[model samples]
Target chain A: MPGWLLWLTGYLVVRVRCAAPERFLNLALAQGLYFWDARWMGEEWLEIRIRAGDFRRLRPAARQARARVRIRRRVGLPFWWRALRRRPGLLWGVVSVVAAVYVWSCFVWSVEVAAPEGWQRLGPGDILAWAEENSLRPPVLRANLDANRLAEKLMLDRQELAWAGIRLAGTRVIIEVVERRFPDTATSTGPAHLVAERDAVVEEVTVIAGQARVKPGDTVRRGQILIAGIMLPEEGDQAQPGQGFSRPRLVSARGRVWGRVWYEAVGQAPLVEEERVPTGNQVREIKVIVAGREINVKPLRGIPYASFQEERWWWAWPVWRGFSLPLAVEAGTYREVEVRRHGRSLEQALDAARARVTAYLRVQIPAPAEILEEQVQVLPATPGQVRVRVTWQVRQNIATVFPLK
Target chain B: MAQGEKSSGGSKLRRVESSLVELLDLPADVVFDLPRLTVIGNRRVVVQNHRGIVAYTPRQVRVGATGGEVEITGEELQLEAILSEEVVVRGRIARINLRLT
Candidate 1:
């Protein structure tokens, strides 16, 4: 608004030389003109301000009053226009920059969706598909956008999402989401029996919400009930207690049943083998490409070494200030070129075979299993092969839910 | 009546008009057409409802007022602004004199 005053009024400083400059000032004031910041310049000269528009009107009065007016300085918008006219290139640059910013703001440049921690079900692809389907894709105009309404609509459609928010930051549309949590454990809903999943001897059984049918020393097979879903009725008739026609009530069952289990593995390793290792010598080849035109800068037509491990590497195109060209470069290298034969004694090979067998058995056991016993033995096998057999006894949870019929 | 008698009667009427202005709480400059001078800290002087300037110099300035000429003597005297009805002086003011002209 202050600039509006400067531009609309178009102020300038004038130096006036006259016998009575006050007479010229009073005449201007009488015509509803304004001036300020006047300074005396010795003799009959004085410096004062007047509007550029009123300068022409002042000339007549100045002539009549015998006052000489000379423009000392021009300011404000008119001055800026004259200055810009002298340098056309600078004026064009300024105008182009303003226009470019305007055009850039009209389109949505990027759609960014950040994933929440521990939320693997809702992926970036899923959010993008949903956003595109909902008309929130890139190249969208920011004007007439209702962010809150879009967020509410997204939340209403996505059952897994507990919260959804849309933010327009610069040229990017950012969607922040929070997913609903899935329960780690399920609750018993109806009457059911805790059945054994595998054949094993019961180690320890703890009843939490149902009747226990198996003791610590009892042996159970797969599909056998470990905890009962039915309990004895308190008011049962004594005569009908052992009858075949009596019906039993059912209830939801929950309990923990630990049992003893065993696993075995066999492995073999040869006494002699070959290993390829790095010889600390490598050849690198590079290529360059700009705007889809590729230049071949290969060091050689093919790998010269008799035996070499080749590795491929690629560099992507460069992008700056939202401008990119379809250009990329790929490079390759040949390394780890030496191969040697290594030999091991029978004891070392047997140790390696035993380690392999142990590792195989350890993978079969659960992380919470407690190993109660372990056994190993050397086996007779073909020539140049070390055969090993390993066995383990572990205590594990074997209880599984089974609804009563 | 003679011209001198008529001028005497005009003076008597002007005196009555000056008294009427005070009684009505009106500005004497508006009622009697007198120039108004305002000074601030001996550094600047503003004259409102002024007539014209008689003489101008660096150390002294003479501005025309109603029925008199006002003179200001100062160091580095500068006329700040000159409008039809107002004149402003800026500098270190030393002395001010009013002489009927």
Candidate 2:
């Protein structure tokens, strides 16, 4: 028989001590009792393994053969189960652990949010807070959550999101978001004039349905009209200077005009600045946290630094992706630091201020605009401070429609 | 004179039966009440159509057959399994002998 079958049915190792052990074995075999691994331990002693159920039948054979059969060891599953029955506490402990793990698996342990590239208006924290308000928080039962319906509701509520997808992965919830894209150009239906959006030197003009007021190389103010909605008659079509044959026609103006625009920004930096320098003295504390209660793992006195910077790391017991145990380890490190004034040269301060101005100007430029030239100027400022002004010249569309009253 | 005739007739019948078995191309062990022993590279021996275990020891094992006993002599011989009709012995088999009644 296979070893597994033997274990399942249980077996016993028996020692037969008699003058004629062969007679005993033959008698047992005649009675249809299965035995295996028969060995001679001595001249008059024999060791044999028999199925547990067949061991009881060996007594009559042993008596007839004038042999003594003593069980040397009890083996296999039945004996183990019998021992377990004697100690209920150990059995209950094993069962309790299995049940606890199964119960823990039925609830969500963590949640993750993924947003598309170039999207930052909504963060994971914001989405989690929204889910908390909607009763979809972590540690909730998996059966109670409807991922598809929740995703649909999220898309309906957040106008900025074009699409939302929620997925339940074991003990974790994953949410993916895509932001809505709006068209850049907006159209006006009524009659309007295309005017300069900012003060710039006109570079070129293409008129589609209007008369061009400014040409290339012309300087225009912010409100100056680049294309007029009213078009006068051609020179040949006019009757005379005082008496006009044809009247001016009013129509919506549609055109694109390019211009060179300049932007200026100011930045200041102090020559002497306060800096915090670490003294190389650091203290660390580690603790194990279970259910929000912490037990210190490292023995240490209270932190000694009056002025220190602290960095902390928390790690939870991760079972798998989207699954974790409630047990966590938290480690905190505190580094002592002292504040001191650092001095820099005037030239260095000026360079620092200029970098600040450049960074500020980058944010103000539009995506479609192309930078053509740059200029920087140092200005007089208060003592111990440097002030720098930066300018950028960019080429972009300057035409914006203004409705006619 | 009658006993001599009866012995001769019995011998003739036995010879006829053996001939018929050979002509029909049947296995001899099955046609006649016999035991078949399979030996595997001097490592183990399996006896089929066994009557019972006659004697067993670490170095030797004897199993009863239809008309004789099959004896196995080896070192550290073990009766891996035993039943009324089959017996399996595993060891470094040095010799095997069939003693007829």
Candidate 3:
């Protein structure tokens, strides 16, 4: 046996004989000494021996200390009995094995494949399953699905997609889409036979292309053929054989189809104004964010605004154990701005109205359309108020040409 | 022994003994008990620990002292006596002065 084993055996024999074993053990421990070879030998028995110097020190007190020590030792008997009966050493061995298996499975197992944008209307679950079947899941192939590439593929497949992109942060997948652009047929293809988009008298015809079928003074209805694309053979050429009677050719024609267009736009300015002054007040606040949600630091009271708008968005990140979150807040202040105005004469208001109407018409009509005439009439409603009506005639070449065979 | 003779003898002896005691207790350093008079020639007076006199009147007198020369209002007075310890003041028989304790 080892030297420590021999020593522990002797100590145990001495302890069994002593009346106060606790004191002896304490004295031995206090002397900066220990018996290293106290092996537990089956149930109800522990064998140990103390060092020679420790044994001498404990010898005098051993008889009295032994009894107390034995009582203390008996106090832990129930717990030790349960521990021995349960055999925790074996239980812990099994637990460690199970834990190792769990870790291995977690690191090695494959779940699902997910490509956010490429699959034509594929849902998240479908992509996950694909990833699993293909063994492209995380920690295996180490291939990350390119969201931008997926979005591009989707766009290429669908011509109607105006704008699209894919966002993949962590495991979540998001596909953003914008609708397609549709061209306005009337404006996109310029000059489609200006046959009166509205019905009116032909105030003027600035014929830029094709044969003029109607003059400025002629009255026309909606969808009336103002300029004819079909031309009849000349009288002198009628005798020629195999000469068709009529031929369709492309042509351009334009005329001002006037139909008493009336428009009313009103602008108002205040006669008096109120100003704002500092009230010398202040408030403090604290804000907290949790799980992509914000709890207000303080509630607002007596807020003076005719209208107010608020919008909120949360950003989150996935962690190994849980989620990391942050919140962004934007505040907007709304106040009334005062506008001052003074009374003006009818003639002056009329001139101002005319200038405004001219500017508006100039923006609406293209550069080629020239204003031929303008007339303004002012109807006074009150001493300082007047209603101004302005009428103008403009001429332009709005014609279309079609390919002829 | 006659009673009148005894009374004269006792009165004379008592007077002689009292005078002898007074003489023995008198201040030997003092030459005279006359008041040492100092006229400031102005209304205001200044004294330290002044005591034992009668009434004192302080008039509107601007007094200033600089470089050992004291001026009472505009009037200049030569310092007749100046002791590091105490000052004595005497003036015309207009008013008796009590020094401040």
Q: What would the per-residue lDDT of candidate 1 be over residues A81-146, giving only the tens digit for each residue? A: 888999999999999999999999887889988756546457777878889998887789888567
Report the C-alpha lDDT of model 2 over A115-170, residue by residue, as the tens digit.
Answer: 86546456777778878888887789998998878999988676567789888777
List clash counts for every candidate, in order.
Answer: 9, 0, 25
Worst 10 residues of 3 chain A by lDDT: A67-76
What interface RMSD do all candidates show, one decimal each?
3.6, 1.3, 48.6
Better of 2 and 3 by TM-score: 2
Per-residue lDDT of A17-99 in model 3, one digit per residue for the tens?
A: 33333244344444544543232233333334443344455444454444322211211333344565699787677779899
Which of candidates 1 and 2 reaches a greater TM-score? 2
- Candidate 2 regions with alpha-carbon error over 4 angstroms: A41-45, A110-138, A142-405, B1-14, B39-43, B73-75, B92-101
Instruction: Look at candidate 1 and give me any clashing residue pairs.
Output: A25-B83, A25-B84, A26-B83, A26-B84, A26-B85, A27-B84, A38-B80, A40-B79, A191-A251
Using all chains and alpha carbons, the TM-scores for the candidates as numbered come to 0.42, 0.45, 0.31
Classified by CAPRI criteria, candidate 3 counts as incorrect
Provide the lowest-lDDT 10-residue window in model 2 chain A: A179-188
RMSD of each: 26.2, 25.3, 37.4
Off by over 4 Å in 3: A1-194, A197-209, A220-223, A234-292, A304-326, A334-359, A380-385, A398-405, B1-101
